[model samples]
Target: MKKMNIKKILVGTAAGAVMLGSMAIPVLAAKPANDVLVKNWFVYNRSSDFAKLWDDNKATVLDNGGVGFTFNNVGATTWYTAYLKAHYNGDLTGKTITANVSVTEDNATFVTRGDGSTSTVGIVIKSAEGNWGVNDYWWPTNRQLLSALGTDVDIIASTSDSNRANWINICGLPATDATIHSGPDCVGGTYPAESPYDGFTNALKNVKEVGLSFGGSGYARGVALTGGTASFQLNSFTVAE
Candidate 1:
């Protein structure tokens, strides 16, 4: 009887370990098999924000010809979504991001984790702290903050600027057993209870990373390139306060 009890305890412990491991794994957002997976940049996505992934990131040079990269994020990943991100770290309070760039796509897809419009394409920012900066899933109000690109001003694909008026601050997602933002298009959804406009200002003051968004509205949360090819060409990008 003693031996039997020990055996049962061991088995139960093993089973519990397996269950915990399974619960830890998250769904594939833009992950493709190694044979087809091509990533030019690396970012840490915890569990919920998988819609934002890109195959390449580039920087320009002037002295000896610039380093130019013309990429099509469409069909580049498993979900047929792709983008080019130019990373930056700084304070963007009362500032505007201007870029000389163009995104040419035969098609586009826009999806939001919650209900909001899932819109905007121009400048994507992450805070140096909070969800924008943390890598752990349990972090507070963690999410990628977007600038008012399409709704406030349609400057994408041109040499214009991305405004930060009413930028989208995603709080909850659809698959996370949370309430959606209440809109389908970018800039159309109201702010979630957890994420308010005040949070946006805090994030901007401590901006960690910023990227040039080529996919309008659904810049990073959905199948932006569902049917056709999506290409992003960047010449110059700057932030003005």
Candidate 2:
């Protein structure tokens, strides 16, 4: 509900990639590691606030030593992988993705990035503009990620130092193309949905910028303190064959 005083803004690219500044990002010819998925990223709070970044409080590290994300309600974060640029716009057709999310009882009631409050975990695929597959959970009711989900069960939540809300990615994208979103309106179906190759299918094939969304409905920061500070973390995210 609260907005942040952002200093930096993410610059969109023709390839649907996002850089820290408005400048163009150079092309990369790197490849994935043996045991890891990605090594580079375009990490930022959805708010693009640099207040936290001015200091040494950067985001956490991914499993393969890549960049991950961290933020509060006023500084919710998103980590868009640069694998597309590095690999000439790669496609995640048959690969499986796995990751862990850290949630707190204080954030159980807070809905995640989506429309109106129909928050869910979004695994977006894009190129200039694209679609996403989601796991739309009923806030305060859905306990798939965190036990909180507005239910306040706090059964299997996560913390700053730990991540328990794991995800296997099971959701669907919109019927059209998009880069930014308020949130999802429909229930989750299947990620990287197969078919017509005009919506989700298209985005997955020409993947330019894939987003790992875990912020509040409108980039609300913090994940604890009952929404005082929207601190959240995603860890060990990996895509493998």
Candidate 3:
């Protein structure tokens, strides 16, 4: 219920598509602009604690692998747009985007170079200019991106081992129905019904808008690196606000 310290909402990827209309693009310089829809993104591949949280906060891993962090909000302070939001189902209106993730340590061979070695974590959101389906929220969904602000709500991490199970997600409760909160069990114990997104807790909360197309279950098993190749890479992305 309280443990959201995920460096407070993440970001990266070309200043997140272009830091919101760049200073109101000349003071509403014409009006008719409010397109912001940087959908849900919770990527955490190559989760080895991400180079000690980017060298204890030296933050700066660009070239395509986006992984920067800095904030101030409103009056002063600049540098927006984060990463990981890939999961679209089509028709992303207007356009100003960034979303893609990948991971492959020992799926068997592991040889994904370039942006191929795969291993990028995430959390990026932007959508204000042209607004076309806004509402993005996340909270510990699974294991990587662990913080967010607006839009319905999102959280994951409890696939349920029962009781004090780790975590689990799929929110948006209220109208369209969406509720899957199985766990308090970390000290307690007893809250299992096989819930990862199933066991029916409100099935995906019926997420309204955003790319839509994410796939990755929980895999636990490390320790077997002979040659090299501990994959997990999800290039940066953005569309500021």
How accurate locally, in lDDT, is each candidate?
0.32, 0.31, 0.26
Superposed Cα deviation of residue 130, candidate 3 (Å):
33
Which residue runs of candidate 1 sit more than 4 Å off their true CA positions? 1-83, 103-120, 129-164, 171-195, 214-217, 222-230
Model 2, 8-84: lDDT tens per residue?
11111112211222222222122223222243344443223332331222343332232323233322542211111
- Residue 79 of model 2 has an lDDT of 25
For residues 8-42, write the lDDT of model 1, one tens digit per residue: 00000000111111121111122222211112222
Query: Over the stretch 6-37, how does candidate 3's per-residue lDDT look in tens digits?
Result: 21122332222212111110011111111121
TM-score of each: 0.42, 0.39, 0.23
Who is ahead in TM-score, 2 or 3?
2
- The runs of at least 3 residues in candidate 3 whose Cα sits more than 4 Å from the true structure, single-residue gaps closed, are 1-98, 102-175, 178-216, 219-228, 239-241
Ten-residue stretch with the least lDDT total in model 2: 6-15
Worst 10 residues of 1 by lDDT: 6-15
The alpha-carbon RMSD values of the candidates against the true structure, listed in the order shown, are: 20.3, 15.7, 16.6
| lDDT, residue 47, candidate 1 | 18
